[model samples]
Target: MSRSVSRGVVALLLSCALLLTTGACGGGDDKTSASAAEAPTASASFEQQKLAKTRFVANAGLAAGATYQWIVKPYRAGKFKKGADGRTFALVKAGLAGAFTYNRLKAAVNNAKGDPLLSKAVAPLSAGIESLKDLGTKLRKGEAGDADVGAFENIINSVKDAGKSAGAEVVDKVPSASQLGGG
Candidate 1:
């Protein structure tokens, strides 16, 4: 071979070796690298947190009755299993409640019409949503225990506290008979 051709062959071999070692240029197993690259982004941004908090409060006000319906009614109706070992129903109920709350918050966040406070609330709410999602996954997998429940409760509490901190008041207070009667 000519000297130039020989040098070009050597360069090509070196390039292939580098790609193989670095798992780039398609020379190494792509599955592992692709999965690593494809891992879902889990970090919540500031705007997400703001939106989460705002939506949480709005849902708490707008859907408080629904929350009670889904989480409390079944247990009261005895449709849920009884006994300490039968905590699955309770966990599932709580998970559903959390999921609803998170969904509402996410929607509100996504629908914000450029509100600054809503933007600021998104990150924390996003983190809370991530926690709630993990809790829901655990409940679905039958892997939630007392500790998981406690953690989930804490997350919900934090969301509430964040809402209060953001100056959002509870707008769903019980109305007395006089108020109901338009007195």
Candidate 2:
């Protein structure tokens, strides 16, 4: 074999071996990984599922509260105390809060996996994450307006209703900027 060809083969073999040992290449029966840790070993209990549902509701409620505090109320009152810059800040703040809430809600849903009742109630809410994300993107770009705000409120209402059906309803709880991790 040529020297270059032999060197290439040797490098490839070494890389494969390293990957197999580290369980990165899925070369063996070893399935251990960080993601595996997140997977439930067994179906969640009813109480556990309810708790997760409650958590999802609370997180979503925070986003709703943040929207009202930073966007809706001010817009309705026609008092953007800080002017355009302040309006921009409110939009960005609400957007980040929504994003954060979506992530937390996702985690809660994952934790409640295998519970059909809770899952059914949470499905629509989870599916709305994309729309929520898009709203946030629009807000940040200063392209969001009354229609976007109305859509956001409708989403929040749907989530609240779902939470109620699942017996996990929670009032809106405004989260701090630090909590949203967007400050």
Quick one: best TM-score, which candidate?
2
RMSD of 2: 15.2
TM-score, per-candidate, Cα-based: 0.43, 0.62
- Where's the lowest-lDDT run of ten residues in candidate 1? 173-182
- Please write out the lDDT profile of model 2 over residues 77-126, one tens digit for every residue: 64433454345445555555445555544454553343466668767666
Error of 1 at 23 (Å): 37
Q: 100-123, model 1: which lDDT tens digit per residue? A: 444444444343322355446544
Per-residue lDDT for 5 in model 2?
68
For model 2, what is the alpha-carbon lDDT of residue 53?
58
For each candidate in turn, give its C-alpha RMSD to the true structure in angstroms.
22.7, 15.2
lDDT of 2: 0.56
Candidate 1's C-alpha runs over 4 A off are 1-56, 60-92, 111-114, 170-183
Clashing pairs in 2: none
What value of lDDT does candidate 1 attain over all alpha carbons? 0.44
